[model samples]
Target: MSGSLTAIALDAVLEEHGLTLQQLAALCAVDHDWVSRHIEEGLLTPSQHGGEWRFSSATLLRVRRIANIERQFEALPELAALVADMQEEIDDLRRRLRRAGLE
Candidate 1:
């Protein structure tokens, strides 16, 4: 074991999230390979160590946020502009809903 205390802390964080890589990938709307590669490259750190793979809820959350942004706003400049316009409209609707106490 790397360190008993460190392992214990990692386990605690995993317990709070209770997600597997597949689940996280689904939530992020990205391929499992991408997540795995990112982890292997040390771009993301796992919260817990499984037999072969480690998982970090915090890292997965960040990935999901990025994936959502990318999906909503495609990479192309034209698509990005359209997505931004749509997002602005959505934001306005959300604000109106909140003010109406229906959010």
Candidate 2:
């Protein structure tokens, strides 16, 4: 229920992706607990309401990226999340730079 993941936007993304918790776990090759822990720790957010967890494409990408970072370097979850956050920021900046013809 935080960040820029508005329910309306998520609904639109969900309509396209239609991914469930299990699907996300399978795609990321991780388990349910991993995703749950990330959500509980505020590293990820679920839908604004619902007993089930519905994921968007962005969530899938983020989970895989964070999991890969943690496995590859044996990094802690917090560190991995931090790295993911920085990477997202860098990507956003790059997009802005490209739009401004400065990339």
Local error of candidate 1 at 63, Å? 0.9
Residue range 34-65, candidate 2, lDDT tens digits: 99999999998766425677787677778988
Candidate 2, residue 59: Cα displacement in angstroms equals 1.1
- List the global CA lDDT of all models: 0.64, 0.85
Model 2: how far residue 97 lies from native, Å: 0.8
Give the per-residue lDDT digits (tens) of candidate 1, residues 7-81: 778668766655677877886777888777666755556666555454565555556655555566655433443
lDDT of 1 at 53: 54
Candidate 1 backbone collisions, by pair = 47-55, 47-56
- Model 1: how far is 47 from its true place, Å? 3.7
Report lDDT (Cα) of residue 9, candidate 2: 85
Instruction: Give the CA lDDT, 0 to 100, for residue 7 in model 1.
Output: 70
Q: Positional deviation of 26 in candidate 1, in angstroms? A: 1.4
Please state the error at residue 37 of candidate 1 in Å: 1.8
lDDT of 2 at 101: 100
